[model samples]
Target: MNIEFKKNKLSIALSIALLTNLSLMAEEKSPKELDSVTVIGNENSDYKSKEKVKLNRTKMDIEDTAKSIQSFNENFIEDSQLQNIENIITMSSNTVYNGDNHGRTNDISMRGFSGVPILIDGLKVTNKMAHPEVYNFESIEIQKGPDSLQYGESSPGGIVNLVKKKPTKETLGKIELEVSDNSSYTPKLDVAGSLNKEESLYFRLVSVLKYDEGWTNSNTETNKVFIAPSLSYDVNDNHTLTFMAEYTDETTPSSFGTYVNSKGNLVAPIKNTISNPDEEFEKTQKIIGFDLDSTFDTWNSNFRYRYIDYEGDNGNVHMPQSYNEATNIVSRAFASQKQEFEEHALQYTLNKEIDILEFKNKISLGADYNKAYSKLDMFYDPSTPYLINLSHPSYEHLTSASEHSGVMDMSSDKTYVESWGTFLQDSIYLTNNLIFNAGVRYSESKPKNGQRSDALTPSFGLVYHFSDQTSIYTNYSESFTPNSQEDTSGNILDPEEGKGYEIGIKQKLFDDNLNLTAAIFKIEKENIAELDPDDPTLSKYKASGKQESRGFELDINGNITPNWSIVASYGYTDTKNKDNNNLDLKNIPEHTANIFTSYYLTSFGLPNTYIGGGAKYLGSRYADENNKIKFDSEIIYNATVGYKKGRWRANLSVQNLTDEEYVDGALSSNARGTRVYVGTPRTLLATISYSF
Candidate 1:
């Protein structure tokens, strides 16, 4: 027989044997309910989440986990009307909104580290150029510090995991429409139901369409379409499979926001843009994946696979090079790029619980493999200088690749990366009050054009429970990230390494409805790729730099009363470049705070009505590595009123209640002046939703 045929024959034989065994086992076992689907909504629709699934590759109570984990459920996302992942960062601790990189990347800084990885479920998203849509996700989980044991080759700062909505056993449907003051309209649909009377097979479909006119004077319109469908099948009482697919197509302005002059003052109005009218970014992403869960006599196993295809086109982007404040003229260069990325990932995990030496031990073992290929085609028009008078900007003279013609420089390249890892973990219940956890992972990364790197990372933790409602924990973890930069000698540098230490306390009050946590952490990173001080040309880099970040964070979430819910966070971060005379890191705020609370009007005889308001404070931050330019602290306020009766719900939200003028993020600074992102002005959004 042919090799391919032989493989297929073997697969079929294995499937048949497995089914036969399951059938025999079913005949001998008693009838039981099928495994429950993961639910995102908490009891009473509260803001707090009781458990996290991605942290350990298994659902576990947050109080029992040694790491610092924060969860925002669907209720919070709906109440806040979060549009994307960037909005969720504001409510998190020790995080900075680093602006979407001209609507091309999810630029964010977590715990003083930039470029944190984003995951769907437990798998990494290879393409980071597009922002993740929030409508399809049921919850967002932020895992602080190094989590390399579960996720390989990630920034030590943290990882963000988006939990997707799953098929429900009961028939349900929801329709919603939203209108914003900025001439934006959105319609969304969500439906889920069981396919059979036995409820063993189920399906869900979610979709959203949005159109928004330009918010600024420039032609910065936005359009988006997203659809996701999923299915869940129970092969038997001991096995389950879930299939998921997603499609997204979106276009948004590739705006650089406002600019700052030499005197550190904003040069343009909040609603004005310096970008060309025709500049825009477009992206289309598609994903298909499946998960298999199995329970054997002695262990439980999970297998997952995902394939992703992404394409992005960034139109002509104007990059300011130099600004003459006295002449009121800004010189810029133009560039356009198109990227294509495809990725395939596979993961398998097994878990078992047993007693060793009379001590209860939960052991977990897993392996994962990921392969990705990317191609980039770029065109630059640096030879043709494009100058614009900021005092009276005109788009007629804007330069694009088509305009430059023969003067443009073109380049194309293709690259691929293959990575694999295996991890083992054990959680030991030493006693009723004390628990110990240990894990180790061995990972390897091989790039098509770069050197191969491998590492063995370890994590250790201890948790002590004072009572059922209070606990204290400490953890130490290490992270490894392969480096692609090269020195002047054209040699790839060694991988970056990180070490993190944290201690925290957790408390539950109000009958476990309210959860509070406080943590202090220190992170040390080495082998950072930085500009070679010796390389005067600024074209080479060296990986000899080191950095450190130490911080304290406090988070509170849940209900103060049956009718009152609150979510609050505060962080104090101190970061320094150990190799650069202890200079403060750019855009890393020293103090950040947020608080949002809502109260139902049940006492006022309107149980269906609620009023909520909150404020976000971003502390002073430096715009550059030299710390010569600083941005003052700013506080923005927001409010919302919501009412629901029967199957109908309505909400009105007002953002930037005071029309605060502030810098949301600093992208970069140079002789051309500072490229800063401005905060959104006062805006209103109204939403009406119906459920059946």
Candidate 2:
């Protein structure tokens, strides 16, 4: 009963606030004048103008789209000091970060599912799961629900796209240095300008270098280097070309985390605990891409090609499941795994605008092809394991046996996966205020170890504009996920199929300075891949499971007043596995909320100063499939202060202000041993930037 009351109260409070703001705007501006209002504001304003692509392959206002989409603009990214992709995911609505032990790789979950695809500038960089440097992108787009019609196969969670910063005609540059309480130091530079007198040749360059001493008491350290360069050339008024390249290298020589003890309890042995002194993680990534954009009198076209390479080596310490409760002695192991990946992809789209039988119409056709190859070599030293006294531990005896043997075995062999897809979408306008959307796609995927899988998915949506400031939208979409596991006959199982439905409302108030969104959605998935009951082996699988999820979300962003800005969101999700006796899914919270607000002190004689704070809450969650183990809820706080004068800006930000200890990510409970990643404690960062 209390939960219901709180939900109602939140909905009522937000509704009242939005209505009050709308009424006040109505009194200040005439209807004709309101028509000229824009939802996007300047850098100083909290709101950003909409520049996201719609499902129909058309550039339209986000408020007019039929599905839920969110944008984190450059201004907000800087204000929040979002230095990494994981930081951005933490701030997104209805999202959860599945942190890896190393804190370098990111896996995000939404709507009770995982494997959310990540794209760069509408192109797939890596399907093998990788994270790009956050500093290379200008904006990040979050699309919710089943998007298989546009992309290919995907989980029900949704997708994230990063848009890179392009070259500009005017000279713009910024250099910044940051110092963090966690013994971390970073230096970054961004410069973009034209290269020729014609103003048609432009270039942009971005670089970052970071080094951090051990955050824990262990003898661990981390270092990273990143560089990106891009160029743009205009052949004519209707034709343009762009080229982009990026490289990243990161290394961490220490492995530190908590482990599950014999009593099935998570234990942080010690701050100075180092299972293996020689443990290290190293990664390198490179990407090169080009874009060809053309515009004709009645049609528009875009063609893109990209090649990406990624390699990683991890020689890390491990905690074994064997623990002696009486003597407090736990077993430890070691592993060395190396992974290599290469991908080549091409994507093209053609769109035409026309008038059909007095109704305006926009039609688009697109095709994408991707080929990926990956190899994995893993060696584990579990035979001669090391024993550790949990009460008083010493790692002097722990060493890799392979260092002396010089033989590295291989596991999982080599994997090669490829996919191709074609799609068609159309948007028909019944009237200037009402729009209908429909799309269909056919995709095929083949893995080296499994048979081919094909899927045909379709989507439909509608958007109705009640007024210039308000709109209501609804969509029905389908999705499919290909299984990499092979059956006893060496044939892949049928792809898991999912269907989703969503309805939402978007509104603009206070002369388009504020934006509000509310949405409700549900998804059902079938034919989920599961272990073969009779012959449960790593090489065999079956598809006979089902799951369902229902959720609702509310979000608000923009300026409440000329001096005050706010961003807030609330999400509620309910999920169950039907075949598993309706057991709750693991690692998904039931309720989550985040609120951030900032105010300028210009009126108080501090012309260029600002202060802001935020709060994040995650509800209790189940840790295992049977729901036997659970993790308690937690609330975190953050604060920021900044000043901008002339071309100089400086900011100080603190995270986890209350020093809360929480688990940011974890592995499945069904595993041999559950690995838990502890969240960062209270930390401070100070940065200063100068722009020209």
TM values, all candidates: 0.91, 0.89
Per-residue lDDT tens digits for candidate 1, residues 556-659, read: 88889988998899999999999879998888899999988888898998888888988999999888888888888889998999987765788999988999
lDDT of 2 at 368: 95
Give the RMSD in angstroms, all C-alphas superposed, for model 1.
9.8
Task: Find the 10 residues in a row with the least total lDDT in model 1.
Answer: 33-42
Q: State the lDDT of candidate 2 residue by residue for 463-533, as single tens digits.
A: 99999899999999999988777677777788999899999999887788888888999989988888877
Supply the global lDDT for candidate 1. Answer: 0.81
Worst lDDT 10-window in candidate 2: 36-45
Residue 517 shift from truth in candidate 1, angstroms: 0.9
Runs in model 1 deviating more than 4 A are 1-44, 296-298, 317-319, 397-400, 534-539
**lDDT for each candidate structure:** 0.81, 0.75
Q: Give model 1's TM-score versus the native structure.
A: 0.91
Best by lDDT: 1
